[model samples]
Target: MIDTRMIGDVRVTRIHEYSGPTHDPKFLLPDLSQELLESNREWMSPHHWIPLMNKLILTVQLWVVHAGSNIIVVDTGVGNRKPREGMARMHNLNSLVLEWLEAAGAPPDKVTHVALTHLHMDHVGWNTRWLDGRWTPTFPNARYYLPQDDFLFCESGRNKQEGLDVFGASFEDSVMPIVDAGMSVMLKPGMEIGDCLQVEDARGHSPGQVAFRIRSRGEEAIFSGDICHNPIQIVHPEINSGYCIWPDQARKTRMEFLASSADRETLVLPVHFGNPYAGFVRREGAGFRFEPLLW
Candidate 1:
């Protein structure tokens, strides 16, 4: 299923890719306590958490924004036939992302800009596809906007030795092809795209992770990449997903982003979150809470 919302004149749609019980609660969030999980069970159950399986449910999706003449796709989900040797769930397989994209009104050829919040296996997979026996840019007409620090970090081979399959192989297949094709633009902090979207520093989950702020006609929303994998994080802002490379920074960034969203009343659209994937952050007592957007 696809869900869309209009922020003024810009039409933003969430294209579904994969959704299931992805990780153990404690494994995904080391700080999670049984009490905390029970406290939020009323809202998190079924959609965000599976009490029966004791797993945290996550969704891998793409956020396509239609602003004026620009059809910008944010964070492509895992593509077909990628080598995710360590992650069995993400290993070589076929996903109907392209068809989903087409159904959502932003096909590969029609996409004008491809903005990546960060360079991770799941987020960059569809950036390229197997074409004519070689990996090639999926959106031939689009210019990909990649985070500068991540590009440098991945290019340096620093993550090659990391046991987790977040970078090395996927980088070569998904990202490098775009760079080699000269269709990549290194995004910097405060970068603006078409005067509608602004890139802000949202690192910590990955070296150069970012969140895009979409503004139009006094309405606003944020394409928050992985700042909070699950809505539970909004209630417990300090919790970091197991995939987070820099736990401390990740927590700090999440807390700040939640507070800012609550204060600004900005719609928060995270890449992962089950049903009602986007929401508004509400300040609750010492922390914050997620008010899922029904649309």
Candidate 2:
């Protein structure tokens, strides 16, 4: 079933692509503490962590927000039939993101805008589709937004993604097609969409990554894409994901976002969080905690 919720009149839903053990805690998150995991097993077991295999569970899902007359889809998960290498789990696969969107009542062509947090292969795969040997924009009628810095860096072949053979084709397949189709709008750090949405410069995971903030009727929510890959990072905010291009900056941005979420009581929805992919951040000692929320 498609999980639905509302922050004022904005109808929000989650369209999942895949949900399972995407990586080992040690490999993806280099600074995970075994001691913390063992102590927190009572709450983390079977949901966030698989202690037996020492694997961290994650979800690749899309956040669909229906605000005013706009249907904004954030961070499309890996789509079907991409020649993904190195990243074996996401390589050349089929996903139910579109079907689930339909079930949730947000069909493809009806989507007015599609926004990406960054240009990573996993995050932007659905921006285009493989059709008749050509990569094409999957959302034919939607205006796509991408971070200007990321688009430039990746296009220059200087970004970390370019060095990795597996993601070498990502820029061409996922980003260029949108730009070529005249559907991509390169945005800077602080662009606001109407009065209900804005971009937060949350770099680190990528050289030019950003997060989305939405507000309506005095309520607030943030789509914090890839800042914190695991629930453990809420407590150990210092840990950097293997994919982070700017580790120091990523950690700093993460800390700031978490603090803000805790203080403002904003609903923090992440792209790769499991099941109840969102929650409220709370003060827990010197760090913070994720309070899973479902609607």
Candidate 3:
């Protein structure tokens, strides 16, 4: 299913890729306490957390933004038929991401730009599709904006050496093809796309992870990628996901983003948030609260 919302003149549409019970609350967020989980259980049950299954629900999705003539795609989800042996959930499977994008009103061909928050397997998988005989650039007309640090890091094959084969394989099949096709552009902090989307430093989840800030007519929203996987993090910013490479930095980034979003009343659209995916962060006492955008 797709959810559409207007942020001033820019139209934002979320195209769903995958959604289910993903991880254990304690497993995903090691810093979370049972008391805290139980405290928030009333509001989190069924949507963000499944008490019966002891799993944290997550959704893998991408955002399509329409800014005048620019058809921008925010982080692509895991693509069809990829070798992700290390991560069972992302391994050799087929998903109708392209069809969903089309249904969301932004087809692959119409996508003018692709902005990736990081180079993780799930975020960059749809960069290429198995076409003809090999992996090919899925968005042929789009110039893919990739983080320079991550591109260099993944290109160095260090992730594989460090036993992150899932990311390495994804880089090989998904990202490299974009570079080989000469459609890749290095993204930098404070970079603006079409005068509405601005890139901000959001490193921590990955070395070069960044977030996009969309603004128009005084309204704003942040396409935060994996900074906080679930809304639970809004109330507990210190809890870092197990996948975070730099825990300290990740926590700091999350806290900062949450505080800023709350102060500015900006919409928070994280990649792994459950249904009614986007929301607003509001300051509550010493922490924050998530106000889901139900419309």
- TM-score, every prediction: 0.96, 0.95, 0.96
> For candidate 3, lDDT tens digit of each residue in 1-295?
8889999999999988899897878877888887899899988988999988889998889899999999999999998998887667888879888998889878899999999999988899898999999999999999999998888878887766666343667888999889989999999888987567899999888888999999888899999999999999898888888778878999999999998999998999889988788899998898898898976
Which pairs clash in the backbone of model 2? none
What digit string (tens of lDDT, one per residue) describes model 2 on residues 27-68? 877776678678878767677888888888988888888988
Q: For model 1, how does the per-residue alpha-carbon lDDT over 178-222 read when each residue is reduced to its tens digit? A: 999999999988999756789999999989999999888888899
Which candidate gets the maximum lDDT versus the true structure?
1
Worst 10 residues of 2 by lDDT: 159-168
Flag regions of model 1 displaced more than 4 Å: 161-165
Clashes (candidate 2): 0
So what's the TM-score on candidate 1? 0.96
* Lowest lDDT 10-residue stretch of candidate 3: 159-168
Candidate 3 wrongly placed segments (more than 4 Å): 161-166
The per-candidate count of clashes, in order, stands at 0, 0, 0
